[model samples]
Target: MKIKLIAAAAIAALGFATSAQAHKAWLQPSQTVFSDKGAWLTVDAAVSNDLFYFNHVPLPLERLRITAPDGSAVQAQNASTGKLRSVFDVELAQEGTYKIAMVNEGMFASYKLGGEAKRWRGKAEDFKAGIPAGATEVSASESLGRVETFATVGSPTTGVFKASGKGIELVPVTHPNDLFAGEKATFQLLVDGKPAAGLKIEVVPGATRYRDQQNEIHLTSGADGKFEVNWPQAGMYWLETASEDAKTTLPDAKQRRLSYVAVFEVLSQ
Candidate 1:
């Protein structure tokens, strides 16, 4: 996975003085789920205060569009949060790739934060729908299963979760049930059908090739074998979980493994 950090230099080069408009970045949604009914596309954007430090007022969204593979345009409404967020809902009846574009509206122009007015543009492509034949769709039940099994057989088993000590377990957490921006949920890894404790975990938001950016989070399992992380913004985030091992341990002992990951949407609340 490609990870791009928005450096201050890059942001400055975009024409904003270092003092104003600290950083401007896009939060791309990682997963798009399609079904016979329609397709659900979730898009997120992240604007740091530093990036907007110089601006007189908050920048508002101007135009947001979604184009289907067949050249059909889907009208996207600014769902919940109006100014600070750029989110859209597009319906898809057929199977194909989709392209989305969002532009910041007049607010930025009026303030003239930068010498030359600029608009934020973001694009998300290949939004897909429908399920493959053999792949079972992820659901709340499946999410529960993985958590249950992981906690049950820790170090002793080949399953993702392994028992590290008498009361501790180590497991890897990844997609299909991974973390997302603006979400608070918990899934556990059981040790012999009991809650495992002190498991270290990391959540990395996925990146998009179109924009070249990514975000990540680090967390730990609680006494109840549950881990909680909140995505403060919208973007594709990758969730990773592993046992905390000492530096003195062998390299193999510290290897990170894939658990389960799922794409999620964070709407304006």
Candidate 2:
């Protein structure tokens, strides 16, 4: 990619939480459904208290991944990190769906050396080596987080919706680009690339700053890892869910945190 995107080494997200007061991270595209084949799509990535409003900090795109309609990797162009958000552009040369994702995996550690508290955040592979000698009360945790948004030039394609089977992910049974208000959309939630039954899903609409209530919708995946959402209105919505287990890839880490966040635009039918 010609754009100077952030490095994965720079990611410092603490962990994933479903708290209402927690700052939510997201990616918002200028337009979700494009009519032209060669259209240009711009995206803004940020983390903030009020959904879609960039107030807290810019989300680093070190682990950013773009997949074209043909299941090919596409490089972002003219990308830049600003004070409040990171901006990027993608040329929709194909006439199908494109997936823009920021995937991250790292560790958070806390220990004591010489009776002093110390903390670290970086790749999980470095968790053991990064620990200083004589560090007592050493404890660490691994985290995997993904933020994504989809854009389609003409018609949406299913090739870009494949799951990595590593952390938690969403495989849309109902095409994302085909979402319509008042209609129910179905999706398969996966953990470790398998059906994630009984996982809680949170769906919150944008423009939360104007409403006194969050209006967040909560749903759970069925036994087959499928979940359904009936959009109430025509607007951009933030959907997120997380799962935790003792399946840490690192020996020193005791727990693994897996989270998924996606932005979807529901059109009025």
lDDT of 1: 0.35
Q: Candidate 2 deviates by what RMSD?
A: 5.6
Q: What number of clashing residue pairs does each candidate have, in the order they appear?
A: 31, 0
Segments of candidate 2 deviating more than 4 angstroms = 1-20
The C-alpha lDDT values of all candidates are 0.35, 0.83
Candidate 1 ranges with C-alpha deviation above 4 Å: 1-22, 33-37, 49-59, 78-83, 103-269
